[model samples]
Target: MHIVYPAVVSALLFSIGVYGVLARRNTILVLMSVELMLNAVNLNLVAFDVWLRDRLHAGQVLTLFVIVIAAAEVGLGLAIILALYRNRRTVDLDRLRLLAETPAPTGSTSVPGAVSPPSSGPGEGP
Candidate 1:
């Protein structure tokens, strides 16, 4: 096979990955996109290694390293996503913005100079 075949495939994979990362809102999908990008890089690495017919096969070796790092990244990334889902229910990236303004509280109209009642929790003085 010609080198162009794998090279073109790798380029397509990378473009798809970039599109996914840019367009997707769900956290899991974003992570998957990042994985896709990494896989594309791995494909390029191995394809070039074969095309060059290198005795050291350094590209292939680096591809292995990338796979290992990607695995570790996925593990940690999923763990964080799971924790976030537990806390926030939805995994939408826009909704998860840390700096977003908080919505105002509802339905408690206070009169001017009126004091709010205290909570009646346990161990509290009345």
Candidate 2:
């Protein structure tokens, strides 16, 4: 009974996580959803370990590893999102796409045929 209950709960959690990841555009929300999925897997692992009479605590050990990796992933992902936001001044996915549409900033001595020259200028020879 306990095994079945935990398994079902874990599956539900996993499904919810998937939905959140796919439906949400915010990077932070996606990250939180990922964490939720990881936690669901951890719950399943621990539940199975408890149900089975294992010689070694393999499931628990694996759960620990999952938790550690999840923490690292969130840290790295947040850092990347922060950097992107700082560069673009917005976190929305739609707005971020503007970055791709726009060309790189122009400067003196641009590569030939790479970028167009300034429309009008007095001392603009590049």
lDDT for residue 32 in candidate 2, whole number 0-100:
90
Give each model's clash number.
0, 0
Per-residue alpha-carbon lDDT of model 2 for 43-102, expressed as tens digits?
999999888866799999999999999989989999888766544445665444432334
For residue 75, model 2's alpha carbon misses the true position, in angstroms, by 0.7
Model 2 is weakest, by summed lDDT over 10 consecutive residues, at 110-119
Cα lDDT listed for each candidate: 0.79, 0.76
Clashing pairs in 1: none
**TM-score of each candidate structure, all chains considered together:** 0.76, 0.74
The candidate that achieves the highest TM-score relative to the unseen native structure: 1
**What ranges in model 2 sit over 4 Å off?**
98-126
lDDT of 2 at 44: 93
Each prediction's Cα RMSD?
8.8, 7.9
